[model samples]
Target: MSRLNHQWISQLPIKKITNVKPVSGGDINEAYQITTPDKKYFMKVQPNKTAKYFGHEINGLKALGKAIRAPKPLYNGQINGDAYLVLNWIDAGYQGSQSELGQLVAKMHSQTNDKFGFVDNHETGALNKTNNWDDNWSRFYVEQRLEPEIEACEKLGRWNKWRQQHMDNMISAFRKYYQNHEVVPSLCHGDLWSGNYMFDTEGHPLLIDPDAVYGDREYDLAMTTIFGGFNDEFYQAYQQTFPFDDGLQDRLQWYRFFYLCLHLILFGETYGGSVDSILGGF
Candidate 1:
């Protein structure tokens, strides 16, 4: 980790810092556990980036926090060419309630907007996500989400004619299916996975590191399945809180395809078979 500027650290309102130890934030940024006399804090730093680098994250945290337990964003600024974001830290715990997690997530998804998108665009690692508002979920998802990932994969030579043909078929099927269904613009944690959730010291589930958007709630639920953390209890609780419509199982595959295709673009062909598996069904 690069050395944090003492001059900048001293200027913060958080009083005298006793310690600043490096912690696992994510692949995209450098994380640290900041200690003061009375409280602890979490921070993420982006080297050579401006304070605006964390703008999307701050927006996401505030949006998610409205309906669920998320880290409270305390401060964000740039110092000596590095961007930093500080948030109130929640102490980790060993046990978590997946049932409660499900209910809370259901509530989070209940928060909705008239249009599909967010106030700002976001980035997952080096990739860009355009979140311009749209009235049509199908068009917003296809044009803003799927096509961008496909274009990136093509640029990296990870895409081919076979994949393109299958993708086209899948897109056609997706558009056709959504034509008859009514979709609400529900808030979603745009990059939810197993690692993004945790239990706090009091056994409260907290969501962290959100890449948020306002879109189909199913898109958020589909992400939970890609990684093996949430279980049957979670889904059951979610269904009890907010019932899913018919034909959801079939539609989930389309959202899964988008996530796997993104992994293929970010992590190469290791995810190709998984992507093809969904495409073959189309």
Candidate 2:
């Protein structure tokens, strides 16, 4: 353990930790399971001067509240120039029923806001998510979500003439497709995907590492499909509670295109073909 971890652990309003074990499974930050004589805690650390999201993460988890079975924030602060966040460690459980996960997410999505965005900008795998308030969901998605990654990919030489032209055409027709159905400023997990959520020991769903925001609910649902693992029952349950209007199926790919662009920029060219294919459909 580093001195920073010791410093923060010592400061927590709990018994002194007797042991610390590195835990795998985090993609962006170092995760650890720290134990005392009778308790265990989960901690994530990010080096300072990189991206500090502990505060935003705490707010996001708290926003979800007990409505969703998410980790409870315990301690979060900077220690020795390292950003750290601590939470109650949840024990693994069997895969929760897809229907329950779906219903809980739908209930959480029912929480709405007047505008689309979050109070503070958050990091989605080193990428800054723009949360500037916007009353128009489509306009917000275009300017904040799509434009940033698209511009980054172009600057990184990931964009080609064909891709650029289709992207341009897609942007021109963005509002037309996005507005094909009714939408509200539904609270979203922002980065929802199979990996971000898990089942707790009680067979309940627990959402972790959220990039929460008030945006179109479709954006969240769209992410679940981009990466595999979500059962169809989850979608079915969500629709039963808050059904999408006609044309959502057509617009689903459009929403997914945003994430494809993000993956192209964040990971590599493996996602480039997918982005091109989605844009070509425009």
Best by lDDT: 1
Candidates in order, TM-scores: namely 0.97, 0.92
Q: Considering summed lDDT, which 10 consecutive residues are worst modelled in model 1?
A: 1-10
**For residues 1-282, what per-residue lDDT tens digits would candidate 1 score against the true structure?**
446667757765678799888887657888889999999999888888999999999999999998889999999998788898999988899898999899989999999999999999987564689999999999999999999988898899988888899889989988997898879999898777988989998888988888899999999989999988999999999999999887788888989888898888878889999998988886
Evaluated at residue 263, the lDDT of candidate 1 is 87
lDDT of each: 0.89, 0.81
Q: Which regions of candidate 1 fall more than 4 Å away from where they truly are?
A: none
Q: Superposing every Cα of model 1 onto the true structure, what RMSD results?
A: 1.2
Which candidate gets the maximum TM-score versus the true structure? Answer: 1
Model 2: per-residue Cα lDDT over 125-221, one tens digit each: 5366778999888888888888788778777888888987887788878788656655689878878888888898788887888888998887888
Candidate 1 at 93: error in angstroms? 0.6
Q: Between which residue pairs do clashes occur in model 2?
A: none
Per-candidate clash tally: 0, 0
